[model samples]
Target: MHIGLISETFWPDINGVSMTLAQWSQGLLDAGDQLDLITPHAHADTVGLEGIPWQDAKPFRHISASRVPLPGYRGVKLGLMLPKAAKRLWRKSPPDVLYIATEGLLGLDALRYGRQNGIPVVGGFHTNFQYYLHHYHLQWLTPLMRAYLRRFHNACTRTLTPTQAKKNQLLRQKYHRIHRVGRGVDLSQFYPRTTQERSLWRQQHGISDDTLLLGYTGRLAAEKNLSQWIESYQILKSQHPSPVKALIVGDGPWRDHVLSALPDALWLGELTGEALAIAYSAMDIFSFPSMTETYGNVVPEALASGTPVIAFDCAAAHELLQPGKNGDCIGVNEAEDYTARLIHLAHDYQQSPQRWRTASAKSIHHLGWPTVNASFRRHLVQAIHEVKRHGRQRSDFVATKS
Candidate 1:
């Protein structure tokens, strides 16, 4: 099938949406399908997408849409609508399916063109924009955001969510044709490191073998609920007798806040590829306090690296984590409970480190990128069939009316 994948976020943007969409694009191409990647032209120079196998061997096109800096977001841009450009692109060679990965201007334009031209469109619900409102002091926009999201997604043949919990939430809000396509971890790239390698990593950071290293990976932003993470870490260190150190693995607007609050914590900035995997492997415990994740990719990456995770009981944690097993999931918004869990986990680590590591690795062993990519392909096929069937029915109805 010829697929057009549209999103404001793509390569060079170090976020979940961009990474996942890039994987999906390669998956479609590997399956002997054509893909036209429609995204903003931001960070064009930094887009190191040549490493994707399909991009080197298959028929793939990129449509660069105009973009401007997104308001209130540091180093982030929003794609502008270009309906005329979209029409021209599709007029020459229309896609068999349109996958809208975001509800941004670019996605809306693609959705409109797909609808007008009778092309099947599948939307992806990747981010919790409604939850992000409170962080940005735009709580009043919650209702408006919800309404817009509902209308935008409902217009598509189906909307794909990254977690079952998120799909259920969308269903409760009256979202139609919702489907769950959870994210996956690249096992080859994010696996546990050798003991010597892990030791070297700790040594580089001036961390001793006895010290418990707590890690958090992802954007250090307000929407991530990072303040709570720092508070929990501080509480854990205070309560525990063991030497505790923290490693924050991403960069964002909240850098200053994190630095001021946790002065001794190692800020590794943004890391990718093997370096990121090594960081995950080096951690004894991964604490993710974010409450707004659609599906925390870092959670699985940590688990894949044999590192126990502590997270709020939502998103991927709600789905993948089992209390007292691979990791602990604190109740939603229960800050005290979250901190308590962190302390408890630290104690458990001191008791039996090997057992915790084994459990963590075993829990997420099934999450491979190949499996996730196949599931996504199936969803696209289903959306295409639904659209074709509906079109046929409409044609028959019109003939009967005539």
Candidate 2:
């Protein structure tokens, strides 16, 4: 079956959405399906957006990134050239069904064009744009964002999500045709590794054998609540005064802000492949206080790395925690409580790492990407069959009625 994927971003970009797109595209290609991906090609500059060449890896790739123009507050806009982009791919060979990801202009354009052409449309529920508006201090933009997401998703046959938690939340807000597409990780790259990794990381960071290392991995932005981590880190050092080093992996707009605020913390910059593996292995404990994540991909990856994590019991924590054995969860009732628990864990690092190793391995071993990919392939096929069986026009495609 030929499938079309329209996302706002794709690979070589280090974010959760792009990673997931790469995973799903590869998965579909592996399942003996061809994919036509439509997205804003970041590298090119066309009137609206441009296209970049991408090669497929089998049952697994979604190639050829197409771009479009998008406007924003920064004197520039980034987006996909929807109708033109889709037409370009369609001319080669259109897919049996179209899947839209991201709540961006590019995705909406693709969905609109697909419907006009009688192509069955489906969607993936990724970032909650409305929720983000509030976090960005754009309270006035919430209603507009909400309406845009609602109208955009309403046009699809189904909107797939990584967790039932997100699906239920979207449904409560009246999101139509929501479906669950469980997310999994690559166990091979993120599983328990004992010796060489830890030693090398400690050496690189200039830490002695007795030092306790606490780390955070993922984007460092205002939404992540990194300020609290700094405050909490200060409190921990002052109260207990242990030889603890803080390691930050990954970079974002907040890099300067973080460096200015916490001058002593080791900045590993952006890490990938084995470097990412080494960064995770080097850390003794993982702590995150980010409020903006839909599902903190790092939590599962940390657990898979046999590194214990302490996170507020919301979203990702709500989904991944088995409690005490593998990880420690902070109460969602308040933010201070989250900070307090991280303090407690920092005071005693030995027990947390030992217990976390066993639990982390348990959590990641069975969640290989193959499982999630296979399920998605079946879902795409099923949506295609549903359209055919019902003979619904693209514009007439109704989200699965609750």
Candidate 3:
């Protein structure tokens, strides 16, 4: 089946959504499904990627707001994608399925085109635009963001979410055709028992053996609730005479601010491939404060790499984190409690290494990309069947009237 995937983010810009889409596209291509991806051509004239298979890529009209940097992620842009751009490029090659990923302008445009043209439209929740408002002190806009999100996802034939809690939340909002599309992990890339790797990674970053390495990955911007992290770290420092070391992977607009906030932390800018893998393996504990993620991709990645995670009770924590099994999920917005957990973990760093490694390894198996793709394909096929059943039902009613 041919499927057209549209989003506001793509490669050359590596975030969770972009990477997840790329992996799913590869898995679909392997499954012999043709994919035509509609995304912002942020970098014009960009060509084939390295080590990745050949794929079709297209660009759309970039809005003035399109180029604006996400407050937390310096590398990614937050803009409305013009659906007309999808229309111009995809009208001829429209797929049996039109999968929309983001809720920005481009997504709306794609939804409009899909509805008008009678193509099956499916949406997947990738980011949390509402929780972001709280980080930036725009908490009052919660209703607007929720309404916008509900309207967008409701338009799809089905809305795919990674967690059960989110599914319930969306259902309450009256979102249509909501379904749980489980995510998978690349187990080969991340595993435990890398002592030398941990050593090398630590030495490379000047993290001594006695120093507790608390790693946090993702954008360094405001939406990630990074101030909470810093405050937590300070709390750790105030109690413990020895300062715990922090390793921040990934880059964003907040990089400069992060430096100003905590100049002493080890910053590896944006890392990928084996480098990212080793970074994950070396951390004693994983702490992520960002509520803007529908699913925090790095949480699983960290787990697979054998590091235990610490996140608030939301998003990926609700789906992937199995409380004491894989990682710890702090109470909602309980930054002090979040900090205390990390501090407690840091004190017992030596004891946690093996337990966390085992937990991480166990959680990784559930998220195989091939498995996720198969289930998703089934959902699409089922949705199409439902549409057909409804169409035939309508036809029979008209025949009876005649």
Candidate 4:
């Protein structure tokens, strides 16, 4: 099968969407399927490309366009592609199915091209861009953004989201042909290490084995809802009998603010590969506070690393977490509950550390990259088959009525 992935973000961008795309591209290529990628140039985020294996994962054909840095974001950028270029590229070597990953101008242009050319276009709901407006003080434009997203996705043959909860939400909002396709974790890279190994790593970093190390790994952004989580951590630290410390990973526009908020934290900025896997293993607990995430890739990644997670009952947590067994999945906006859960988990860990180690290993072992990539491939094939069964005429593509 030949697949076309159109997105504003890709490899080296250091985000959930890009990471997932990279995984899918590599998996598909390994399976003997062809893939064409269209995204912003890696030079847009020069630093991000340093450790990323951009040379290893090669797609069939790659297309890049001009990009401008997004306001308030350091390395993030929005891609700009002309319609003529898109048409010309596809006319020469078109793909069997087109997957639109981002709701930016580049994705929209590719979507339009696919629709006009009778190609099967599948939209991916990866990020909650509409909800992000609240963090940027553009709440007034949220409704407009929401409507635009709905229309854009509805126009596609099928829309794929990472979690069942997100699929349900889109369905309630009248989104057509919504499907649930999950994200996966690389267990080989992110899995449990021995207690002695963890102890040695912690000791080297000046962290005691007895102290509870609460951590957050992802982009430090306003929409991530980091500040509230930091506050909850502070509250947990003060009230809990056990000693607690923080380990902050990743960097973004909110880096300075997070630094100021958690001055005593071990701030290791943007770790990858083995370094990133070790960081997750060192943490006693992983807390994800972002209510705006469509999937929250960190949840499974943390669980895979044998680090118990604490997250709001939304997104991936709504599906993956089993409260008290695997990790605490508190209700959204319940700040007190979030703090209380952290304290409770910390106490439980101190009493029986082995229990959490066992739970973490068993929690998300089913979410390997092979299973996710296969499911995604099936969806793309389904879309292609649908287009073929029905004619390519606009009237024949009644996805909205489906």
Candidate 5:
């Protein structure tokens, strides 16, 4: 099958959407399918993807759309509105299925073109854009955003959500044809390292053996609710006997703000590949307070790296994390409750680190990429078949009437 993916975010973006799409694309190609990616051009000096091998002799084709910096966002770009260009490309060589991964201008154009040409379109709900409006001080636009999202998704044959919880929320909002497809983690790349290797990693980073390292791996932005994580760390540091260290990975516009507030914390800007895996393994606990995530990719990755997590009882945490088993999932928006749990986990880990690490690793052992990719492929084929069946039914009815 020939599939076309349209998104504003793709390779070199270093976010959950890009990462998941990359894995899914590779999986489809490996399973004897062809793909055509349409995405925004990378920013100056940023790395972009090279050629990908396909079942056909021709290399994977990437159509680079023009991009401009997104308003009120740092290090983010919005693809130029290009309905004509998209229409031209699709009309020349139509795809068997079209998957829209974002609701940005680029994705909207592709959705419009595909619908007009009688092509089956599948949408993926990856981000909580409505929740983000409050963070950006555009709360007034919440209703508008929700209405637009509902209309956008209802037009697609099926809208794929990362969690059943998210699908339920969309159903409550009157979204149509919503499907649940969860994310997966790379077990080989994110598993636990040896005790000696972890000790050496800490030594290299100037962390003493006794220090309790609490880590946060994602974009440092206001919408992420990072200040709550900082407050929780402060509370844990005050109560715990062992020295406590905060390790922050990834960079965003709020990096300077976090740095000013917590000057002593270690900030490792955007570690990828093995470096990211090692960082996750070296941490004693992964602290996340964000409530706006559709699915927190870091949560499962942390668990796979043998590090327990402390996250709000929402989104992926609600789906994956079990209280008092692998990690603690506190009440949603309950700051005091979250902080207390953090302190308790810290103290408990100090007593039995090996047991907690083993439980953490065991929790997410089944979230391999192959299972996730297979599910995605099945859904794509199902949508295509449904659309074709409906089309045939409509044609037969018209012929009978004539």
Candidate 6:
């Protein structure tokens, strides 16, 4: 099968959607399927991201769209390809299915072209753009944005979200044919380090082995609710009996702001491959305070590395966090509750480190990439079959008229 993936984000962009697409595309390629990636041209500065096998001179085709820097977030770009441009690229060798992974203009053009040409199109709900409006001082646009998103996804053959909670939420908002498609972490790539290795890593970072190292991975954006993350860490550092330090991974438009607030934190900007694994393994606990996520991939990645997480009860946290076992999930937008839970978890870790470590490592062992990719492939295939069935019905009606 041939698949065309349309997204504003792709490999080399340090975000969940980019990473997830890279993994899924690799799975499709391994299963003997052809792919064409449609995304914004990678900027000259977008280097040192996790390398993908197919990013350069790989089997799949690459198509670049016209792009502009997103307002207020110069580090990210939005893409758009005109309808004629899309047609010219796919006139002879169009894909069997089209996956629209972002709701930007690029994806909008792809959806229009796919529908006009009778190609199957599937949508992915990866980010909460509406919730982000509040952070950007555009809360007045929330209802309009929500309506536009509903219309956009509803036009697709099916809309796939990363968690059941999101699917239920979209369904409540009158979305059609919503499906839950979860993500997976690479067990081999994100497992826990040995005791000695963890100790050595902490030593290298100027941290004592016994000190509690709290970490936060992913973009340091306003939507991530990072102010609260900083507040929680400050509270812990001041009051906790054990020494507490923070490790900040990844970078974004909010980099300067985060650095200003956390001058003492160890800032490891945008690591991938083995280095990222070590960052996760080196931490004693992980905090992901973002309530505005379709699914927080960092939560699982941290869990896979034996780092228990404290997050809001939404997205991937709602599905993966086992409260007392793996980590704790606070109520959505409950700032005080989030800080309390993080402190409580830290105390629990001090009491019984082995229990937390074992459970965190074992909790997500079932979420292998192969299983997740296979299920996603099946969904895409089903969309193609549905299009074919509809085509056959239309042909039969014409034949009866003749």
Error of model 3, residue 123, in angstroms: 1.0
Q: What is the C-alpha lDDT of each candidate?
A: 0.83, 0.71, 0.72, 0.83, 0.84, 0.85
Question: Ten residues in a row with the worst lDDT in model 3?
Answer: 393-402
Model 3 TM-score on a 0 to 1 scale: 0.86
Q: What does candidate 1 score on TM? A: 0.93
Candidate 2: segments with Cα more than 4 A from true spot: 42-77, 83-85, 393-402
Score candidate 5 by lDDT. Answer: 0.84
> Each candidate's TM vs. the true structure?
0.93, 0.88, 0.86, 0.93, 0.93, 0.93
Model 3, 170-288: lDDT tens digits are 89878877998867677777667467868876787777877777788887778888888888876776686465777889776678877787777888888877788888888888889
What is the Cα-based TM-score of model 4?
0.93
Q: Model 5: how far is 210 from its true place, Å?
A: 0.5
Top lDDT model: 6
Once fitted onto the true fold, the runs of candidate 6 whose alpha carbons sit more than 4 angstroms away are 42-50, 53-57, 82-86, 392-402
Off by over 4 Å in 1: 42-48, 51-59, 83-86, 392-402
Q: Across residues 146-168, which tens digit of lDDT does each residue of candidate 5 receive?
A: 98888888888889999988899
lDDT for model 4: 0.83
Error of 3 at 230 (Å): 0.5
How many clashes in candidate 2? 19
Please give the lDDT score at residue 82 for candidate 2.
Answer: 64
Worst 10 residues of 5 by lDDT: 393-402
Q: Lowest lDDT 10-mer window, candidate 2?
A: 45-54
Q: How close is candidate 2 to the true structure, as a TM-score?
A: 0.88
Candidate 4 deviant stretches above 4 angstroms: 42-56, 82-86, 393-402
